[model samples]
Each structure stands twice: as C-alpha cells, then as structure tokens.
Target: MQKPEEAYSIRVIPDVKIVNKGILHTENKIEGEEYRSYIFLNFERITNKGYEASPTIRDDTLYYVNTKRNSLVMQKEFGQPEELFKLGKISKYTFHDKGILVIGEDKTDKKSPFVASKLKYRFDSRGLLRSRLSLYLFSHGELRKVVSGDFDVTDVATNGKRIIISATKEGDDYGLGDLYEVDVETGELKRITKGEGTVVAVAMNEKGEVAYLGHREGKTPWSTAKVILPELGITYQCGKTCGNHVLSDLFDGVKDRLIFEGDVIVSPGQEGGEAHLYLLSDGKSQKMTDGKIVVRSFDYKEGKLVYTYSTPEKPVVLYYEGQTYDPNPDVKGLSPQRVEVNGIEGWAIISGENNPTILFIHGGPHTAYGYAYFIEFQYFARNGYNVIYSNPRGSQGYGEEFAKACVGDWGGKDMNDLLLFVEEVKRKYNLKGKIGVTGGSYGGFMTNWLVTQTNVFSAAISERGISNLVSMCGTSDIGFWFNAVESGVTDPWTEESQMKLMRMSPIYYVKNVKTPTMLIHGEEDYRCPIEQSEQFFIALKMNGVDTILVRYQQDSHEHARRGKPKNMRDRLERKLEWFDKYLKK
Candidate 1:
C-alpha cells in the first residue's frame, strides 16, 4: 500500500522574507524594466538558521548584525556582503557616522550543539540567563567599550550628542520599563521616564523632540504616545486620545510629523481589524493609506511613501511610483468572509459544502487575528475543510480593558469566549456534530484545556501546549516571569500559588477528555518544551483515550510558524491526517 497524497506541498509556499529597518535601494531594477524602481533590502533570508535583525544604513554602507553567524556584516554601496566584525549573540545595533554601537552577550561558554548562545540558558533565581549586555563602539578599525551593564535594552536612538535607550532593569516587572539618556562626551547617564509602562520604539525629531510608543497598566495595545522634552521636563500625549486604535513602530517624519501603523478594531468584540498608515502632524492625526489594505513596514521621504502592502488574499508587495513588486508570487491567494458572531468578530473561509469544520485559535493570548495572509489557514481551507478563526477577549487590537480582562483569569473568561464562538459558528453553519479544534502556543494550551473541559468537538490538535503550569514555570524560557504575571501569583514557591497553577492547568482534568487528541511539539522548544506534550500524552494513554504525539527534532517553540521547511510540512501533514481519521470518519 502506498501513502496518500498530501493536501498541501511546501514547495509552493515562498521562503520567509522580512524587511526590518529597510533602506531605499535607489539603483535596483526589476527584470526587463529600463527605469530604476525603488526596492527594499532585506537584512537576512530565512533558511536553516532563521532570519536576523534589521540592518542599519550609514553613508551608503549597510551594516547588519547576524544573530545566526554571531557576526556583523557591512555592504558598501549595495556591493557584496562582507564580514565587518565578530560580535557574539547580538540583540540590537545602531550605526553612527563616527562609529557603530553593538549590544549583545558574550556566549563562549556553552558546550551544547543545540545552544545558539549563552542567552538560551536559564539561571535559578533569574529565570533565563541574564547576561550583562556590554556596549562596544567600533570606529576607524578599532573597538572600544562604551558602557557595560545588566540591562535588557529594547531599542536605541541617537542624536549626534546624546543617546536614548529603552530598557528594563533587573527585578522590574515584566512588560514595564523606563527610558534613559546618555551624554556621549561625558558619559553622563540620566533617567528620563519615571516608570511609564513598557517603553519601545524610541525616535527623535530633528528639532530635538522625542517620541515613543508605550503601554501603561490596564492597556491592551501599545498605543500610548508620549512626547518629552528633557530640558523642560514636559511630557504630553502627541496623537489623538487612544480609543480603538493600537499603534506600532514609530518613525520621525518630515517637519515635526510622526508616522505609524495603527491596527484599527472595527468589530465590537474583535481583537483586530485592518491596519492603516497614520500621520500625526501638529497634534492632529490623519489616516494615510486606504482603510482596507494592510501596511507592514513603511518609510516616507520627501512626500513619497514606500511601503509593503498585503491583504487576506494578497502576499506582501512593495508599492511605490506606480510599480508593485510581489516577493512571493507562487503562494496561492485566499478570500475569507468576515463573520460577526453575536457581537463577536471572526472570519470563515469555507472550501466545500458539508465539509468538516475546524475552528482555529490564534496564539499570543495577547496577539490578535487580523485581515492578513495565513498560509496554514489557507491550506486547510483549500483541502476541503471549513476553516474558522476568531479573536476573543485578552487579544490585542481591541480596547485596553478588553485585552486585559483575561490577564489574571487565564482559563476563565477567554475560554468562555471561545466556546461561545464555536457554538455560534456551529449553529450558523449547521455543523454541530462535525466540528474540530486546533491551535498552537497559547492557542495550543486552550485546545488542550477545551478538550478536557468538554467533549463537544470530535477531534483536537494541540501544538506546543502547556498542560501543567507548575512544571512550565520552571522549565520554559521566560517561564518564571510569564507564569507569575499571567497566573496572578506573587510567589511561585507558595502552596496557594502552586494550587492555582494546577487548577488552571489542563493535565489535572485529563481523565474527562473524550475527544481524540493529537499532540505536536518541537523537541528543542524551550518556550513550552516537549515535556508538556509528553505529560498530556501519558495522561490520555492512562485513561485509554486515543492520542498521538509528534515531535520535530530540528525545531523550537516556533516550529509551526517559523521552523524548517520540511518540518513545517510534516507537522501540517500530521494534523491533516489526524483530523481526517477522526472528524471525516
């Protein structure tokens, strides 16, 4: 007997191409075009090692710190890629006219082949290994130490005389930080912000006005904008008062204007909707792009805007001067219908009538499902399955209160929201008895939790899920901080906290699960770890429930989304097969 044909092939899905800190390639041209078309440069391509950070350009030379090779490369005038220096485990870099500032950990101690850097290792009290990120300044073929400290810098911006950095100090609450200014001439460091949420994406205008994006307590999206003048100690909100828009990626535009992409939540209870470019000038805000299209990374120069645009049915394309360049033309397009389920928002991409319905949940618990292209969802839809997805409470893009509603109550209201969504979809489509469920990460946790809580669905697929929160707190990366914050536990060592974690975990109620389950995980996943799936698998086996576990060796926590091409394909095939055996039959 021969194996059955797979519904989707990885060959057609294009390689991952991301443009971070993109620079305008003025001299590049499209094939068969005589005129020079504006093209963006990608810092790194996704291969076996994964993509690197964005590149910083200075004086016709492009400089990028490759986290994969643990080195920095310089390309002068779009020539060839050349190795400039070896800086191990770099997290961020900034290019100056006089020198380059590189920040990373010194990871020459680890002996494991799977360990990418020393940052991957975790300490007992500090959770993940907290290495002192030293700052080095390279100038005139020489490297000099600028500063060395134990701070996790999120972003950095410079203004010739001063450097502004956003960082969270040791022992500070997670997702909350402060801003600091450093004088270059005297090495004088000054704390700027006074515990104002998680400050990120700092930018300075030519007139010395500073702007940043941050989120305060009880906020969902990072849309809070603050403008500060250090000389006067004056700070105020720059854009329109935050309502339904979640802002991201702040850039200094021409003449005291700031440009950013705002994900606007259109549906009442939905987490996200379409994203549009917005311009803030003179204390007023205006939408730049059409409200329907989604804009990713964009840069404005001399009134001309260069941006990458995509939609639910479109791949990422560069748009400028009546020319559009599609990076991945081979990937198939899809059309998902916008669904409003009892004041909640969702999307459905139905393939065939009477097909088995699968409800997909997104991860992040903080992240939202938007009107963008998702290859996996498209694959399932094309393979004769009704794919449904929704953004419940605790998801971003909605208001701050709605997003924070599920923070401390993890398997509580958010799970109720998902159950309501499934019931509404089943009733609307008349497919109550032929439904299935699947998700990854936090979504995976919810899948496991849902199956154990109820037996409504015929099949369940959980990937990289957290079955036991007590073990998860000690094993996964960032688990120490994340588990405490999400579970509302001030002390993990206490018995009360332990019991709270156990109550929220799915493994405690595994014996009640009747739906057939398939567990998928990456062997090297430090985020959730393979033990999570293993524990759940063992529980199901002991209960005599039908369950299968699939582990990918060469992948990590992000295997389903950003793992190797072959492993991603194999994981998807396993999911399709499991659902077919259970739901189709």
Candidate 2:
C-alpha cells in the first residue's frame, strides 16, 4: 500500500493566557508587546488522558476530569498533576471554594455488571439494567454521595453557594429535562427552569447570576438558543440578525458581559457558516472575532481574549495577543469548494485529476459538516480522492425545521438528499468514474441504506452502522429512546412497529446490495454495537456479496474519533485499502 498519506491531525492548546501586570506596570509588559510575545509554551512535563470536559479554573489552578481514568485532576502552577477523585464516567463537574461536586455513574456495585449480563437477552426493559449516574461531593480528598437516584445530573454549575444543574429525568419528552438549583448545605433542590427543550450548557458567575443555553418550550429545537439569565431576569441573544447557533456555554468569568462561540446562520439548511467569538453586553450582542475565520473556546479576562482560531486551510492555532502556536504545523491542508445541491449545503475538496470520488457523511444525523478543518477529509484528499461531504436534512447548524425534517424519516428524504448530492457533484464535476461512500453511526446507516437502494456506489464502507433498527433499539446504549424518538415509533415492541422498523432496516435490503462493502466496527461499541455490523456482514456473505468485517477489540463506537492513535491509524489504513482494492480497480 502507498505510504500512509501525510499524518494530519489537529491539536488544541488549552488554557493559554498572558500574565498581566498587577500593581507593577512595567514597560516590558506593555499591552501591545504582551500580545505579540505571548508565546504558547509547551509544558511537556504534565500530561494525562485527554482533558475530559471543560477544565474549570479556580484560584489560579486548573481542574478537569480525565475521561480515560474517569478521575478528577488538578494542575496548580503547572506542577505535577494531582488526582483528586477517582470517579467513573464523570459526566459533569463543578468546583467551588467549599469543595468539588461531580456527577457520574457509580460503578461501586459490581453486581451491576452481572445484572446487565442477566438482562442482555431480555426485551425492551433491558434499559433498566444500565447503571444510573448520581451526584457526589468531593471535599478534603474524601468523596461523599450527595444525590443518588434515577435521573442524570448534567451541566453542573456553582456560584460558591448554590449549585445549578441540568437534571434529565428518564421518560421525559425527548429525554430533555429542566434545570434545578440545589442548596450546598441543606441539599434542598428547587426547579429553576421548566421546558420541553434540551439544555446544552449551564454556568453561574461569581455574582450568583445563572446563565444557561437551551431551547425554549415553543422555540425551534435547532435554532440558536439565547443565553437565559434567570437570576438577572434577562434573555441575552446574539447581535447578529441572522440566527446564531451557540456552541458553548457562557463562561463563568462573566463580570459585565457574556462570551461564547457560535456560528451565524447565513442561509437555510446551512450548518456552520462562519464561527465567531460573540460578546453579549449592555443588552446587546457583538461579534468579537473576525467574521471570516472560525474561533472557538475563548477565555476572556481583563479586556483580553485567548482563543483557538482556524481557517479551512489552517489547523487550529492558539491565538493570544498577536502570538500564534500551531500544534500540527507539518500537516498538509486543502481548500474545499462550498457546494449546494437542492438547497442542502456541502463542501467538495478535490485532489489529483481522474481520482475516484468518495462521498463522506458525518454522524449525529444532528451534527453537520462545517467549514472547519477535518483531518479525515484532508487524508482522503491527500490519498488522491475527491471528498464530498454535506449536511442534509436532520443536520444541526441549520434552522430548526430543517434539522427535524429527517427525525422520523431517516433513510427517507435524507437518503434522497444524499442521492441528489451525489448526482449534483457527478454532473457538476463531470467525467465521473466509480464513486465510493462511507460514514460512521447515522452516516453508516445511510451508507448501508444507499448501497441497497441503488448500485450507484462502486464500493462502500459502513462503520458502526445500524443494520436492524429493531435489534438496535434493544441493544444500543440509547437504542430504545433514540430509535423511538428518531423513528417516531413510541412503542417499538409492538408487532406493527417492529415490522415498520424491519422495513426501514438495511438488513432487509442487504440482499439487493451488489457493491463490495467493508464493515468496520469497534467490538465494544455500545452505541451501534458490533452486532449491527455482524448482521449486515452475515447477510451480505450469505447472499454471496463481496464484503469484509474488521472489528477493533479494544475500541468503542468513538474509535474513529477518540480511539488510540495507533488504532485510529489502523482503521484509516483499512479504509484506504478497502477503497483502493475496489474503487481503484
């Protein structure tokens, strides 16, 4: 095989800030020079499993959960990292002067695993076997269980006194729940906000001002959510007349203004048009960053902003003052052409003439392909393939209605959008040879469905895709609820609903698939599960169709994005080999 294409990966330098002068106003620390020389120093002494959720800064110390170990770690003065709490699957955490509060799954009960195994083969109620996470208080190196129950506490925020949390109760509409405030001492809980929408982020400033991002009950679920300041009794919306898709929570350092990252909606059915740093102050919002570039995860203090900025051709760079640090400087970049098909927006990046084109789809039927640098897309382009990706119906970044268009109609209109996209690109670019298709999760489902619906694709790769919706509903982590919500089938166990699910399943259409397809899945993938790919591979093999299945024993559904570096490379090499074997021939 051709030597692996240029190793292109994006790296983010977190917590890069410029030290401001306190009382000693030295000439060397001039604001202009400080901005220019604020070099991003690589502190190689400290490292941990990828920084979990957002790192909370308290008293000049940084604290964050480690996803790999599910532990809370603290880094003071860039010193050796200290493990504060060894928790499991910490979903959210808040640090205050009193102590640290964490919400995570309690794996203390070893019987939980045995119970899960016992209910593995059971019917729809198997969801009950799953472990329920709870809230805990970590103080003075001791962990105390504060709240333990059925609901999941997410987006935890505290203002030193009161803790504000987004509590998601099971069986709530769309599984979204309300925000509640809890007393730190009394442990009394009070519902602060009630709505049908899903709360994404929550934060409380030092002044006890609670700011949250969520869709109101009647608003479009996909529309940009305004920052709701309940304590201040004000709703802060972006200044852009166009809809703004907020991507992060209001920073905790909010003194006079609220700051966050989001994209201003430029057109209908568009995902991220141009991400910008937005500042809301004095009852109005203002765009803080350059409108042309994409800026994210910014921290503002004392009239200075530190953020990561990138363009389509440049990987993310930590920008503070005028200094810039590029983590992946050696990585090659590609400029993609923005293309629109039937009002659906996408991008096409071509490399080398007469190269086979691969249509890539993103997962999250809710997530959208934006104008950001994607290593995988660049990898494909570097490997002499034209990569075309788009956000069809059901993709976020678009308006609410467009995002919900495919909610109950997966593999229906979205599939048509994909077909039309392929047709448009083929005709627009002309001289089309063979085309390959691939994606993970929902995108994988689309790939499986596409190959069966039509033999247009010469080759296909379905990674962590769902083949049988009915079986998936019972197997996946969020299987039952997600399937029920996405398919609009409230009762998936009913005979009629089961038949409808089977009809929508790609397994039922596998017999019609003629294209050589390779199935890639992580064996430990609970979201889509290995069985989804297993069922598809078996059906294809039984029908004498060309197919192969590659399973990563140590990986999960997120292997492609978050797996070990070696495993990620192996998976990509496998994809390259599969496409080369079939499409190149």
Candidate 3:
C-alpha cells in the first residue's frame, strides 16, 4: 500500500515573510526540513536550491541569510545574488537607519566562552547554549557591535532610531522574557517590559512607539497571550494573540506576522482553533482575514494582505487577491470533519466504513489540533483507520477561562474530555475492530494516563511522554519550571508536592495499565527527554504488559514531526504495523 507521506507529498513552506518582490519563504518536502528557500516574485521561483533563510527587504532590495557560507546575501530583483556581511549562521536580521541590525554570532569569538553556569542551561531543538548572539549596527559600510551581554537576543524591531528587542537573560525565567529599547546613536539599552510573559512578536514606529504580542503572565500553559501597545498603555485582547497555537508537523517560529502598516497594526489572532489576521487601531481590534484557515505568517501594507496560511485540506500556501503560490501543487490529502462535543472541539477523518479508529492526541496541552494539514493524520487515514483528535481543556484558541480549565488537573477533566470524545465519535461513526491511542509530548502523557485508567484501547503508543513530574523537574529542559507551573507544585522537593506529582503521574498507576504499549523517543529530546519513555517502558515491562521501546539517534523532541525522512518513514511503518498487529487481529 502507498504510504500517506508518499501519497500526500507535502512541500512545507515556512518562515514566510512578505517582500517587495512578493513573498519569500523556505520550502521543504519532509516536514520542517527547511533546507532551501524561494522568492515568489509574481508567483515565480526566483532563486535556486540552497540553504537560504531569514529573507528580508531593505529599501526595495531583498536580502537573506545563506547558511552554507554563514553570511548574508542580496538578491536583486529576480537576478543574481551577492554575499554581504559574513556573519556566523545568521539567526535573524533587520535594517536600521544607517544599514542593518544583524542578530547573529561570531564563529571564532574566543573573548567570551559560552559557559553553562545558569539554572536553565539549555533549550529545546537548539540544544545547549554554546554561543552568545551579538547585536550589530551596520553603518557606512562598517559593522558596530551594539548590545552583547548575558542575554540571548531572539528577535528585534526598529523604526531606525530606537530598536525594540525581545531577549532573555541567563536566568530561570525559561521562555518568559522582557523587551528592551536601544538608542541607535548612543546605544543606550533601556528596559521596556517587566519580564512578564514572553514577547513572541514585536513591532515599532518612528516615534519609538511599541506594540507586542505576548501574555502579561502565563499562569497556566494554556493562558491566552495578548497584544499590547505599551507606549500608549493600551491592550487589545479578544480571544486571540500571536504565536503558533495551531499544532502541525511544520516547525518554525512565526515572526513578522505583527507589523505596523500606516496607522493600523496588523497582528494574528486565534478564535476556536482557527487563526486569522486582525487589524488593531485606536484600541479596537478588527478581524481582517477570514475563512477556516490558520494564518501562520503574513505581510500587509496599503490594504494589500499577503499571508502564509493552511487548512485541513491544504498545506502552507501563499494567499493574496485570490492568488495562491503552492510549492506542492499536485499533491492532494484527505480533509476532516470538524466536530464539537461538550465544549471540546475535534476533527475526524474517515477513510473507510466500519474501520478501526486511531485517537491521536496533540502535544502541548497548550497547542490545539486545528484546521491544518497533518501528514501523520493522513497517514493513519490512508491505512484505512479513521483518525480522531480533539482540543479539550487546557488548550489555546478558547478563552482564558477555557484554556486554564486544566491547569492543576491534568488527568481529571481533560481525560474525561478525551473519553467523551471517543464515546461520541464511536456513537457517530461505524468504528469496528479495536481502537488504538497514540500521542507525543503532552498528548503522549495523556495516552499513557488513558491506558492506566481504562482498558478500552487495545494498543497504545506514547512518544516523548512525561511519566513522572518529580523526576522531570530534574531531568528535562524547562522541566523544572514547566512541570511546577502546570501541576501547581511550585516546590516539588516537599513530601506533599511529591505526592501531588505522583498522583498526577501515569507511571504511578502503571500497575493498572493492561493495554499493549509501545514507547518511541529521541535520544536528544530534552523537552520530554528519552528518560521519560524509558521509565514508562520499564514500568510496563515489569508489570507484564506487552511493551517495547524504540529509540531514535541524534533526534530531539521534534523527531516525529521533523526528523530525518528515513526515521520518519520507519516511524510511520512501525505505527501501521503496531496497530495492524493488535487491532486487525
């Protein structure tokens, strides 16, 4: 049988930003493998295949970062490219009053060594903190270093005078960071935000006015972030905020989505699982873009809106004036039936009649399974298994109350929501044979927890799941603060806190789990870590439950969504094999 990855060959285009030449984005075939970029000038490919990224416009001319040479390149009006500042693997860059504010690192800088001296020493995907990113103001054919300190500058926005930057110091704040303002002349760095929640997206005006998309404080993981105009002391929050709340196989931070165009501020907003572009002006928020689509990245200027978006039926495609530039044109994937049950929103993709069911859970209890194309879901459907996934309590896109509903109660009502979804789905569809459950990250935790509570599922697979909150604090990256905040055990060293963590842990109840289970994890996944899977696998093995552990080398938390094609194909084949072995028999 043809696999779904082969049948629905998705060409993922992410890091898309609008430019004068049209839109610039990186396209790849195997999910988050953004190795090459292209410029769609009048919907035509302008550049050849190379490791290109961070495409930006400076005074009508296009410039992008070339990873192969570790330098910046200039693409002139669908013509040849010129290599500019040869920085070390440019992370992000923007033009200033004189030239460009380059946010990258120096490859051979030995003055300051990257020491893991802080409480939180590492981050997910990027691995350990090895280099310090410096800010440089390039002017008059010369580069001047701006602020290079203990903080890591991830993003920046400038009106040519005062530059607004979102950075995190070598503290224990995790992702919760603050913003700063730097004078272009004196290079005077001033604090803007009070280190509340993370400043995910930022924009600035000529008057040094600033508006950012972030949360005041994300008490729970599902807390909805807000768009704040701090200079005017105005906050425009209406069931929305900027960031990638919609979960998919594509992996890249959505930047340049919030921009100040003329008098209006265009920002992305989420409502119920679908995301769209919104215009914020004079304290009022207006929904600018429409449809059941998730707007990932966009650029708007002078009433023209060009955005990178996706639906359950389509992958990431550029949209402007009813025109779409699809990187993958001929590939067609299965669509889903959107459903809601007891305030829980879900999608069901049916491939055949009376087929076995696969209850796929989304990772981040914070991230929602929205109206976006997912190859894994299509993979299950192509194998004659109906897929059902839902966003229950503790999911974004819903209001703050709904999002925070599962704050300290992970396996309580959230578990009920999944159970209710399965019940409603089976009642609504002709689900025959046996049902299998699978999920990664937080979804993986739920998959493990579900089998312990009920023996309904015949086979279960948990990828990069959390089994013990107490041990997670000591082992995983962001585990100390993240597990504490989510479980409300601010101090896990205490006896009571340990009991609370144990009560919420699926491993604590492994004795009750009778379903045959399989564990898959990456060797380098610091977010949930491989130890999480190892613990669960051993517990199930000791309990005499049919279990096996599959470990992928040199892969991280995103191995399933964005791993090597060989490993990804093997994962899909194993998934089909496991389900067919148990469910088909």
lDDT of each residue in 435-533, candidate 2, tens digit only? 999999998999999988998999999998989999998787777767866787778899988888888889988889899999999877877988999
Q: List the residue pairs that clash in candidate 3.
A: none
What residue pairs clash in candidate 2, if any at all?
35-322
* TM-score of structure candidate 3: 0.94
Q: Candidate 1 on 1-585: residue-level lDDT in tens?
A: 112123222111111122234434321111221111122354123222232334556666666555457787787774877876775477567665567776666655445343325323653222345455566667878766565555566666665545776666532434456667765545456777764475645665444455555544322232333443444454444223222232111110001123322311111111256655555554444566664454555556445566665566664566765566664566555688777765567878876558898988877777667676666777777667888888787776665566667777878888888889877776776764478999888889999999988887899999988899899887876676677778888776699999999998999899899999999998788888789999999999889999999988767776765555567667777888898898788
In candidate 2, which residue ranges exceed 4 Å CA deviation?
1-10, 14-85, 89-94, 103-113, 116-133, 170-174, 216-226, 230-273, 291-294
**Between the candidate structures 1 and 2, which one is better when assessed by lDDT?**
2
Clashes of 1: 0
Residue-by-residue lDDT tens digits, candidate 3, 440-549? 99999999999999999999999989898889988887887888888987787789988999899999999999999999998889899888899999989988999999
List the global CA lDDT of all models: 0.62, 0.66, 0.78
- Judging by TM-score against the true structure, name the best candidate: 3
lDDT over C-alpha atoms for residue 410 of model 3: 91
Candidates ranked, most accurate by TM-score first: 3, 2, 1
